[model samples]
Target: MKIHLTSVLVDDQAAALHFYTEVLGFLKKHDVPLGEQDRWLTVVSPEEPGGTELLLEPARHPAARTYRDALVEDGIPLAQFTVDDVAAEYERLSALGVRFTQKPLETGPVTTAVLDDTCGNLIQIASRPR
Candidate 1:
């Protein structure tokens, strides 16, 4: 079996869409209206257009809000995205005024950096040595 879709709890879907697409370089795959000012918005990486999608789920549910807040309070990342180079991605994002909680750091064979998603979540960008 393989992964299909995953989600990241977001306080604002519009803002999340902008960051995920315009900044993070993901492409909007699906955006169907779900009523009540909400939508079934999802994004996919350009390199893998048919791959797994990342849903920008609204954090309206009490449990989801609490969970997101708790993770943020503890400085934990809500999701991670693999990149070719953590440092380069960090620099590119930094230039776009993106705020990072942790600079790129090497940990054994992998490198990682954490950044605020501006949608109430900290997301990690990671790279592994080839």
Candidate 2:
């Protein structure tokens, strides 16, 4: 009935953490070491600390790597995050040296922009007229 957690495959968990937290403005919710080199890492939006968590899962699985690579090759975003204003967020992120695959594009009542996560995924930021 409700969503608790979701995941985005990351090539490097540490780098993903930095980008998701320092750049994307998410807060770390969970960080448990799973093995010698991997950890069960997750992050939540600062505005919604108790909301759904996003797992920065390692993309060690071959299938996951292939799937992510294909999506990137096609310039398709692997995940999307809602923001108050896509254009504003795009500007803020761009100032931080983030590379955007697609600039903010308005389509009807919604606006969206796609940016590389730096850890091997294209993430989209979107906003709808409110």
Candidate 3:
């Protein structure tokens, strides 16, 4: 079966939506109420709307809480995005007041950096050699 959906453990789905959409330039695709004050929300890339959807799910469940906590403790990233120019993208986003954890650094044929997604997530942006 094809993988239909993927999800991210967020502390607040609404805030995650804002960060992904407003800051990261994603567009909201689906938002439906799942429970009282709970929602099933997803965001997609504007340039590649059919590429993939990022589920903005809450981490109130025990398993999600543990996973997110462990990731944060280990200082690992929750997700990564491929870019054509890591430094340029980093500077563009930074000028928009985006906070980054690391600046672009070359690692072999790829240059990469990390940014605070503002949703309890570390997002890595990388530019790989062709």
Candidate 4:
């Protein structure tokens, strides 16, 4: 009846961790090594520590690579995160050197921006009038 966790396929988990935490401000929740090269890593929004977690899953499967690559090639975002102010968040992130494919644009009552996650995914940040 409720959402629990979701994931983004990442080319490098370590780099994704840094970008999601240090840049995007999510807090690390779980970090367990699954094998010699992979770890069961997840992060939660700082504002909702007990909310759904976002897993930074490794893109080890060939299908995952093809899917992600195709999405990127088509300028589609793999995931979207909600924020309070899309414009402010876009400015803050841009100042940190995050490359955005789409700048904040208003569409009806909602605004959104898309940025590269730096670990092989395009992410969208969105906000709607409160």
Candidate 5:
């Protein structure tokens, strides 16, 4: 079996799209209008054009808001993305004015950092040990 699609609840799909693509370097894959000011928007990593897609789902549901709020309140990342080098990525992103909650820290065989997504979520960027 293979993974297909996953999602991150976003307060604003448009803003999320801009951040994920223009900033994080993901490519837009699908964008079908779903009515009521919402769309089925998704993005895929440039390195893996046909790989799993990340859906920028709207957090309009009551339960979704509650869950997202709790996660943010606890300083938890809404999603994680693998990078070639955590420190380099962090430096680049920081230079772009991205706010990070956690700086790159080595934990055993992996290094990770958390940054604000600017659309109501904290996202983690990590690098696995070589």
Candidate 6:
């Protein structure tokens, strides 16, 4: 089976959607009410419209709290996104006022950078030699 969806835990779904779409240039595909204030929101790559969905999940749950806290405490990265040009993407997002934890730097075969999502998640942007 193909991987159709992957979830990212966020403190606020709306804020995550804004960051993913408005800031990162992703496109929103589905956003339906899940009940109360909860929503089943998703984003897709602009280049691959229906390829995969990034589930914007709330981190208020006990399991999510534990998992996110553990990662933050250990200073470990939470997720990585590959880009064609990390430096350019980094600059573009920086201009949009995104907070970056680390500047872009060469790491062996890959050049990478890191940023905070403001929702207890560290996002990594990387590019490898072609």
TM-score each candidate: 0.96, 0.96, 0.89, 0.97, 0.96, 0.91
Q: For residues 1-130, what per-residue lDDT tens digits would candidate 5 score against the true structure?
A: 8889999989999999999999999999999999889999999999999999999999889898788788888889989999999999999999999999999999889999999999889999989777
Expressed as tens digits, the lDDT of each residue in 30-67 for candidate 4 is 99999899999999999999999999999999899889
State in Å the error of residue 35, model 5.
1.4
List the lowest-lDDT window of 10 residues for candidate 3: 66-75
Per-residue lDDT of model 1, residues 17-65, tens digit only: 9999999999999999998899999999999999999999998998887
TM-score of candidate 2 on Cα atoms, chains taken together: 0.96
Provide the lowest-lDDT 10-residue window in model 5.
64-73
Please identify model 3 stretches exceeding 4 Å from their true place: none
- Runs with alpha carbons beyond 4 Å of true place in candidate 1: none
Could you give candidate 6's per-residue lDDT for residues 1-130 as a string of tens digits? 8999998899999899989998988899999999899899999989899798988987777888888888776656687888999999999989988888788989888999888887788888899676
Q: Lowest summed lDDT over 10 consecutive residues: which window, candidate 6?
A: 71-80
Q: How accurate locally is residue 83 in candidate 1, as Cα lDDT from 0 to 100?
A: 98
Clashing residue pairs, backbone N/CA/C < 3 A, model 3: none
Query: By summed lDDT, which 10 consecutive residues of candidate 1 come out lowest?
Result: 65-74
* lDDT for position 35 in model 6: 82
Clash count list over all predictions: 0, 0, 0, 0, 0, 0
After aligning candidate 1 to the native by TM-score, how far in Å is the CA of 41 from where it should be? 0.4
lDDT of 5 at 28: 100
Question: Considering summed lDDT, which 10 consecutive residues are worst modelled in model 4?
Answer: 121-130
Considering TM-score, which of the candidate structures 3 and 5 is the better prediction for this target? 5
